[model samples]
Target: MSVLRSGSPHRPARSLATVAGILLALVSLLLGLPGTAGAAATQRAPEPRHPEQDWAGSQIARHEGTADGGAPPAAPLASVEGVDVSSHNGNVAWSTLWNSGVRFAYVKATESTSYTNPYFAQQYNGSYNAGMIRGAYHFATPDTSSGAAQAAYFVSHGGGWSKDGKTLPGALDMEYNPYGATCYGLSAAGLVNWMKDWFATYKARTGRDAVLYTSTGWWKQCTGNSAAFGAVNPLWIPRYGSSAGELPAGWGFHTIWQYTSSGPTVGDHNRFNGAMDRLRALANG
Candidate 1:
């Protein structure tokens, strides 16, 4: 997501105390003492008390639901609710998320080629433990490093999928650049080339196509509206205000629609284009 965007873009903060705590735990583990990591995983992970209170009350327009728009979609909104999150969300209450009818989640795993979300394991595994279909995504930085290198970094970190029948394929968050240029200093053709490298490398390593999370505007501006990935990669479209709008060049319809960036609960709200059975099939595959 763009740093210029309106929603909580989840800017990363390096907390020395948190790092020191993790280091101490690692040292203890290496010294033959029981580690907190194991305990943290085996037990119910701590849930942020009043997590919703942390909401900045700010939301992106494209993420607003139909109530705010006051106009109905040409077709009914799809069923099967889901959410996507990053560090900006802090500790997620996976139990509450499930109880709230959140059937799935896509957590931010890695960004560019260097940064990985500190809370990836907790969010990803936690959601799975809560019985929600889970997936992970990488924030693409076409300008920072080679796309192949970044994809490798992402998979190694948390973007890899297993055949556990519950892990959704990793998604590539290729939207407006968070840095200086919207297209990250690449021409339209260059952006497409970068995407080709990234997707091919990800698929080669993971044996599954990466989901493409993008908006029509960003796709058009960066990739010159190329629909090359449309057939292979599933489209996760983001459109605000109304339920329907112009789509990116290639796909006739989106497999998943992220209706709002800001929903009643934490993270962005989304829906699968098909029924829950189809969503489950996708997850299983």
Candidate 2:
């Protein structure tokens, strides 16, 4: 028989009881139970975020229209949602994007005359395989090379067109100059001529006019409000500040509008300027 150190036969039972009390206290503290030591410690609140800031790229930005806010433009200009991607987005799971309600995608194919997106094949074809209307775009560098040369390079790489009724026409991305000289050191008329030369060559090669992607401000500053491209080429305008902003001269309406860069997918968020039928018609060409 084991003798208790204290002259009490119940000493072991008392000691066990003490230990059990201590264990319960530890568990309470660990779990931050009410009236426990851990409950006294303060926890800082999470940092605040802006309406437009979606750091994870999992949430669409505020400007993206939802049913709760309002429907997209109406009638002749009602919209269907879409997106555009570049090398910056890296490799994307195209189905995930399509499931997220993206009906179309414009993948970055070429920049200037030499640079081609290494992932062009996967993005361009993957989008199609995943059931999204697909197209390619070229970032213009008119300062370093003529528009026709870049267009040629663009098409040869991945900007080519087919009458498959699922391929949207290629786009000319002539936005703010990412390189030196914002206007490419060209006068307004010179810019117009360069665009015409590129468009003309692209038409001759592909038999379809390339979409023109630009902003009202950029068009005014660089092209001197030239409406020369308004009649033929579809306009893909970017105006993130509002539902719709001033359009470039010549085009009475925009074909596509890039509303936000922080879309749930891996690209800038955009919308078709029409409903399903219109989008299908565009793809047919």
Candidate 3:
């Protein structure tokens, strides 16, 4: 799970009022108050009607097959269904997640430098204890200072993959590194070299090939023409919205298509990462 910190490349922070409301709700629940009591706290507050809507809501709606306006139900996860957990969304209740149709998770482990996730221990421990299949991800950093060191740090702090050989392999999160900008910053050849170094070191330590995660644009600009590395490791491509139907050229054989940034799960407002069975098969393979 990559820490989409306040300074991270993607989305901005949530409003203060939103944070306050969530905290208040949590506090009320902790005090053993009734559900209606918590609901009443904002009855006359003139807040947004869907005030409780958060990432978790988006996820629930997506998973319940209600996201696109009375759309048909999504395919079942009897053989393959998964989610990616990160510190940004905090720790999810393992029981709730399992019951909500999630079969596996790729939890965040480390970012650049020594910045290990605050929730890594809790999420990993809870999921593992529950016997859930899991994998780890390292936030890719091109900050010449210690890219390899950061990779090593993630592996060290995030714990190793499940030994039962059922866990998805580890991944290098190369989406939006503030230091590296995007894969565009690296020349096509440079991108290959960088991935080679990272993957080689990762496999040497974990005994599994590193799964490379990237968005469409990043893949086109950084690795579109590089057969040297792309052919060796599995690719996890992220393409949101209707355009998800259009995958990157030359990389049609991706291991995973992160079709939705929002999917249904218990406890959390919206969970991230959902893929088709074909993608799941590739991951499991």
Q: Which stretches of candidate 1 lie over 4 Å from their true place?
A: 1-78
User: How many angstroms is residue 103 displaced in model 1 relative to the true structure, after the best TM-score fit?
Assistant: 0.2
Clashing pairs in 2: none
lDDT of 3 by residue, 1-285 (tens): 666777778876689988777777787877856454467765654322121121112232232242233211354343345566677668778877777666667777776554566787777667756656667777665644345565677678773554464466788876543432455366767766777777777777777787776655555666665555555777766544332344445455666545455455522221223444443443464
Identify the leading candidate in terms of TM-score.
Answer: 1
Q: Better model by TM-score, 1 or 2? A: 1
lDDT of each: 0.77, 0.76, 0.57
Compute each candidate's TM-score over C-alphas. 0.74, 0.73, 0.62
* Candidate 2 ranges beyond 4 A from true positions: 1-77
How do these models rank on TM-score, best leading? 1, 2, 3
Q: What is the alpha-carbon lDDT for the whole of candidate 1?
A: 0.77
Find the candidate with the highest lDDT and give its number.
Answer: 1
Local lDDT at 66 for model 2: 20
Q: Which scores higher on lDDT, 1 or 3?
A: 1
Local error of candidate 1 at 168, Å? 0.4
